[model samples]
Target: MGEENLAAVLHAAEDLRLEKWPLPEPKENEVLVRMARVGICGSDVHFLKHGRIGDFVVKKPMVIGHESSGVVVRCGKAVTSLKPGDKVALEPGVPCRHCSYCKEGIYNVCPKVSFFACPPTSGTMARYFCHPEDFCFKLPDNVSLEEGALLEPLAVGVHSCRRGGVGLGSKVLVIGAGPIGLVTLLTAKAMGAATVILTDVVEQRLEVAKKIGADGTLLTGKLNEEEIVKQIWNLFGGDGPDVALDCSGTEPGQRLAFLAPKPRGVAVMVGVGPPEIKAPLLSACLREVDIKTIFRYCNDYPAALAMLASGKVNVKQLITHNYKLEEALQAFQTARSGVGNPIKIMVHCSQ
Candidate 1:
């Protein structure tokens, strides 16, 4: 192993430097991974551009990626389930098992959780990195590295759907045709949602949603939020969706998620929007709709990997761009620009 690893480090907003960071050693319960693929998530771009996501701020130089898959190059003595050479999809958050949340299996909300790319914790945008062994899921031979890297977003969708109670015969409304929204759409379909309606301001994104089989697509332009909600209701044949997921993290989209669901339905807030949201809680209360929210994810990595292995969900086709790790700055530029109809931009580190 090299003494130093190449990594994309974010020093401040819009400041990313490719520097040689010292190679990390595996802890007793960790495994050393030679990263193969790393996907640039919206949060990653947000951190690069704005230097923070809600309360998590980039106080110092931090490695800037989390959606990752890699080959196990070494394992600590205490790592029993996996050995060297295992291809794995990394679940980036490691919570304190002693915490009450972790004890209850909702560790995603652990107050002391250490998550990649979330300030103070270095991430996997490097040639090599080390993570807790249990958090690294072995990938099946049929699941490509690219697909493995995609599981992070897919897991978010899975967790959101689980929270929203998306199931057979459920009608779903997904507000946002971004990567997360698209994954939510795919998951809703896989979970047997009878009808799925998706909305986005971007026609290109809506086109992707349509190609991926959203039953209805709403292009929100010039229309007021109420008007858009009316159209969304009309799209569902005026019966309202059984579950509405707000993946856009905007106030309007979240308001749509709150108002577009049926009585006693579920509305999931999946994206991180402004710190203080102004959604109508009383309106949802009047309708008796359940409002659910999720953090990153919890106990979903295995299920997501299974979906990929079984071909239940297709993530390979969602990748719209790729770049070597060295081209990370330009890649971030492209991701931020929102040009080229880019859906998922991935950065590769190794074979």
Candidate 2:
């Protein structure tokens, strides 16, 4: 409860430091949280290594994590939803309610949103932080603090599955076995997809996918677009999948997702990729395949929490490594090198 608390700041590219800083106070509608765990997302690593992610450049020193959970230590006067000792997951983005996007129920795309770890917003890679009480969803007793932190990414998976229209007897193909990809696979399976095929370049990741209940795993190493298409078709018995999701964001992965769907099937691009991508659009146009894109997530936290609380999704298997706040540099290094079979690396802020 002291004023000084530890925080991980990205001072410069590949230069992360853990230092003592003043704990922030909550505003009238905010709550002060004692951070429990913070998940190291790919965006975090990108910012640590390059000091920027696309247009959001770190012109000033910024805290490093967004997918996180914490215990509420203090609540503002107007905060009636949460109180002290409540364990909750921070949604990370706060959008202006007056905006058209917010009014239209798509706050994730709000232009006036202030998201954690993005440009000017300081993130939750610290001992204590403050956020809007509404953005903090209380976790049930069955869900651990670590699982609370994972809800952020799991929300994305839920959104992707919803967009892809996954349901009973749905045959789903998930490209990429990274954190988001694995989460998507789990979400699709939980939504009643009979078959889920996961593809990744790393054998270890694919192995993890299988362990996590993926019906099949494919290793696509330097395979051309045609070869990848053939492999996917063969996996689905030469009929193509009911739904294909591109969670890798690579050109090849996106192309494969677009081409792996049967006529009238859906292809959802859930991965983050370059602005301009080259693909075979004519094939998709002729097949009448529907294309959809996801941006973060919307109205998915409640579903993610319900799934976790009900044991419908096993997210614990995705956490492969853990480190203290002081070991942030090593965590970033390990994530960047990809030398080990790391799936989701967590930074323990409370430790």
Q: Write the residue-wise lDDT of candidate 1 on 66-158 in tens digits.
A: 999999999999999999989999998999999889999999989999999998999999999999988999998999999999999999999
lDDT of each: 0.91, 0.91
Could you tell me how far off, in angstroms, the CA of residue 27 lies in candidate 2 after the best superposition? 0.5
- Provide TM-scores for the models: 0.97, 0.98
Residues 1-351 of candidate 2 have per-residue lDDT tens digits of 755779999877878888876778899999999999999999999998899988899988888899999999999999998989999999988999898899999999999899999988889999999999989999999999999999999999999999999999999999999999999999999999999999998888898889889999889988877888888889988889999999998988898888999999999999998888998888998999999999999889999999999999989888989999878878888899886768899999884
lDDT of 2: 0.91
- Pairs with steric clashes in candidate 1: none
* Residues forming the 10-long window of minimal summed lDDT in candidate 2: 1-10
